[model samples]
Target: MKLQVAIDRVSLGYAVNLAEKLDSYVDIVEFGTSIVKDYGLIEIGHHRPAFKHAELLLDLKTFDEGPYEFEKGFDAQADILTVMGAAGADTLAGVHKVAQNRGGDLFIDLMETGTDKIAQISGFTDAIYGIHHSHDAVAGFDAVATVADFHEQFPNVKRISVAGGIDLPTAERLAKQGIAESVIVGSKIIKTADPVAAAKKFMEVIK
Candidate 1:
């Protein structure tokens, strides 16, 4: 399982610094929703905080204007862009198609979406279906259990990713459970004293 480090709620300079250190260790470097909304995508390119090894996944969490948001995101050099699962089927399909056509990855954040909605959008073969537990929600997450349930519920949706309070033991357990394609981490990895060391520990544990 791949680890994606999410950097959020920080200044551009601090984000860049953390990103630079984390670039080689993690599989994906995510500029969380706060970063994009705070600085705007256009400004990100101007700084050109390059990702040497890892792919850049921007957590746009887009709900509407699929094409417009995707276009701007791609222009800003985002390798993978996110869209909300709560969005209309037409909206998800539109962004999924756009993302496919561009040879980029689209992640459908299954945050607060009903099972019916998940069933509706679960047919996109190549698009990654993310089983997301909201950060705002009070309930703690069980990554392995949620992923197993998601896979059991939507067996046809092959590509799966998940996020929410992931830790070393949970990450390794998830990997051993053998479901998620990638695991996204935020504070557990990014909030440590040495993020690189923390990420390395996760990698070792998962391996």
Candidate 2:
């Protein structure tokens, strides 16, 4: 199990500082969509720490103009870029090709995509299919149960990841369930008083 720590809606300097501190603890450090859109690729890209220990997963959340966004993200040195599962198949293919060309992985975020849509996009073997809950949603999200159901619905998809409101205990449960390739955690870590400590604690759960 891999732990992905998200840095979102925070100042650039603070995000960099926190990321550097958390570098050794997490498997992947994710600059969530908010930061990417708020700070732009240049700012977010250059702030990347020299993480000899982890990969950088940038949630660009490319909904349209896939190629351009992926190019910018790759130019900023993102190890992985995300595309919305709700996007057109051609758009997904475009980003996937960009990712392949750049030697970065492509992640299709199944945030609002329906079951039929998921089945259609599940054929991308090199892409990660993310079962994500909405950050703007009012109700509680049960990521593990949702992921298990998604796995049952699309058994052929092997590279699965889950995100949205995940905590250390929840991460531990998800890891024990053994379905997701990686789990993404945001506010619980990024919003803490000591993000590095928070990252380490979450990493322990997955480990």
lDDT top scorer: 1
Give the alpha carbon lDDT tens digit for every residue of 1-207 in model 2: 988888888887877777777787888888878888898899777777678778888888998999999999998888999999999988998999999999999999998899889888899998899988899888899888888888888888989999889988899999999999999988898888888888888877787
**Global CA lDDT of candidate 2, please?**
0.88
lDDT of candidate 1 over 80-186, digit per residue (tens)? 99999999988898898889778899999999999998998888898888888899989898888889888899999988998998888899999898888999989
TM-score of each: 0.97, 0.96
In TM-score terms, candidate 1 sits at: 0.97
Error of 2 at 82 (Å): 0.6
**In every candidate, how many clashes are there?**
0, 0
lDDT, candidate 2, at 20: 73
Residue pairs with clashing backbones, model 1? none
- Model 2 alpha-carbon drift over 4 Å, by segment: none
Q: What local lDDT score does residue 71 receive in model 1, on the 0 to 100 scale? A: 85
